[model samples]
Target: EAGVAQSPRYKIIEKRQSVAFWCNPISGHATLYWYQQILGQGPKLLIQFQNNGVVDDSQLPKDRFSAERLKGVDSTLKIQPAKLEDSAVYLCASSKGWGQIPGGSGNTIYFGEGSWLTVV
Candidate 1:
């Protein structure tokens, strides 16, 4: 049972610059999510994907942020012309499926270490 994997653990860039983060969820997981956690707040869902289709993205800032899960196996999140307010930990999480955990009543989401981004 492996855990979610994320890359470029830390990143620092000037405001208005662009950056991207990658995530590989646990094997066999069918749902993936990307979240943004600012310094003092809880993680906020940016987008969610079930397989290769997007489930929800109402919280995402579409003007500068975008994400995609290709083949339902790997996902990538990109921010272009990022703002200083966007500085935060980008968390990637996954679960077996919505209310479909084997022998479990609820779905358990597994998270990665997180990719830290700083927009200076």
Candidate 2:
């Protein structure tokens, strides 16, 4: 099966610029997620979707970030007017549940090499 796909392995922009990233999850996956990883820190969950419905977006910085899963297949994350602190790796992952998440192979979250964004 094809794994998750991401683009613009790297991006550089000045503070306060708008940028968007795209992701295509694996086929048959029931859940998708977007995470932000700053240099030297663990990835933080930004938004999550169960099909076309958002299941959890608790950590999403709504003030500047927004995302959507239009057709329940692929999704996009947009940062309107990016900030200097937004420089990090945007990662896309997918799992298989909207209910209590299980573990092992079923809960496997495959990462796309990541879209690295730099703000200056």
Candidate 3:
């Protein structure tokens, strides 16, 4: 019934410092995704997880970003040694998994307001 949740609606930190963001997807959702959106641009998929296993992380900046989903529910994304380029909003979204149930391209994702991060 409840929608996705994200914490620290806004965060400001110096570059190279570590920061973590948390997300709680909608209940009953079988798929979760983390996205990074810069000002004015479309959201970029950082990672996607189906249950407890990752389905995609091709766009994730592995050198500084890491994420995990345990119990196939809540998820967390951490940025270690943050970079100036990392200044952007972190968005968490959820949808039905195609493996468990069929989904169409028309199936849209719900997004949180996002956790805005600023690097100084």
Per-model TM values vs. the true structure: 0.95, 0.92, 0.92
* Each model's total of backbone clashes: 0, 0, 0
Model 3 poorest ten-residue lDDT run? 98-107
Q: What local distance difference test score does each model get?
A: 0.95, 0.91, 0.90
TM match of model 2 to true structure? 0.92
Taking the tens digit of each residue's C-alpha lDDT, what string does model 1 give over 1-120?
A: 789999989999999999999999999999999999999999999999999899999999999999999788999999998999999999999988975657768988899999999999
**lDDT value, candidate 2, whole model:** 0.91
lDDT of 2 by residue, 7-114 (tens): 878999998899999999988887999999999999999999999999889999999999999999999999989999999999999876655435534476878889
Error of 2 at 113 (Å): 0.9
Poorly placed runs, candidate 1 (over 4 Å):
100-104
Model 2 pairs whose backbones collide: none
Name the candidate that leads on lDDT. 1
Off by over 4 Å in 2: 101-106
What tens-digit string does per-residue lDDT give for candidate 3 at 87-107? 999999988664433454644
List candidate 3 segments past 4 Å from native: 99-106
Query: Rank order by lDDT, top first?
Result: 1, 2, 3
- Residue 92 displacement in candidate 3 (angstroms): 0.3
What is the Å distance of residue 90 in model 1 from its true position?
A: 0.4
- Model 2: how far residue 112 lies from native, Å: 1.1
